[model samples]
Target: MVKAAAVVIVVVGALGYYVWDYNTSPTGGKAKSEASASAAAEEAKTHDPEVGDCVKVADPQGEPLPTVVDCNSPQAEYKMGEMLPGTQLECASQYDYGIQYHNSRGFDYTLCFTKV
Candidate 1:
């Protein structure tokens, strides 16, 4: 009987803690769920490269995925000149480098870059 009573007391204590925590929390136990969803949505937003932005190339030999960086930073190697939609591109002679990005979903674009 004593062991059964101890187990019941432990279970009751756990339940009491849960009730207190839920009542004291501002969102009543929904804060974590709501915050996680909000954070996921924010992270899903994509960054679009624009003209005049300084970009860094991780490797010229590999597939290009230029990321924007401060022009004054050592990692920045090129200055974006033109951004055109689609794969068919004719970058002007002034641009020193050009990269064509092909999106399998059909939203392709080309980026013209000049040496920084």
Candidate 2:
């Protein structure tokens, strides 16, 4: 019947619209996936602090808030060298090792080094 044919057309049209919308949406389908991938890459870069990374520690005795600085600057407290395990350890030499930790939260690591 004509009504039955009309119903089928309507249903198909609705489905097509939804498919197009999903693909175009910024927070769904391909767009969303690409955005997430970009975010993850940036997060990895932030977490993986490398050697020769200059940082400024606010509190020496308390939990260190190390803000990465230019190694050439006088304010730069430490230049990161090694990646270590756990939270506690002793540096072998006077020029100590800097630690960059990765967790659910943002940069939460200790930079152990003598003053610059």
Candidate 3:
């Protein structure tokens, strides 16, 4: 009876350890990693430019070019805080510093923004 009880205890202990290890393993912790990856992918797609979107400037001193970056990232340098009607961009508000043009083959040339 005592031998049987010892074997059962050892089995239960081993199962508990396996469960803990699996949950803590990086690759095995699928739910957490997958969620974070999806969130990052969503943020990356936001770089296409929309009002109130934060962006990063490739050249801050010269004619600035903007790229969408995670707003919380250190690389973020500007925010598209507004949308003007025409090509002329007269950013009159705070945080509005420069303009980045989206010139495509046939699409209407739109004026995006950067920060001061």
TM-score of each: 0.60, 0.51, 0.44
lDDT of 1 by residue, 2-56 (tens): 9999999999999998988876787777677777888877543313458888988
lDDT of 2 at 22: 85
- Write the candidate numbers in order of decreasing lDDT: 1, 3, 2
Better of 1 and 2 by TM-score: 1
| For every candidate, C-alpha RMSD to the true structure in Å | 5.9, 5.0, 9.9
By lDDT, the best candidate is 1
Ranking by TM-score: 1, 2, 3
lDDT of 1: 0.81
Model 1 TM: 0.60
Which 10 consecutive positions of candidate 1 have the poorest summed lDDT? 40-49
Q: How much lDDT does candidate 2 score?
A: 0.66
TM-score for predicted model 3 compared with the true structure: 0.44
RMSD to the native, candidate 1? 5.9
Overlapping backbone residue pairs in candidate 3 total 0
Question: Which parts of model 3 have CA positions greater than 4 angstroms off?
Answer: 1-47, 100-116
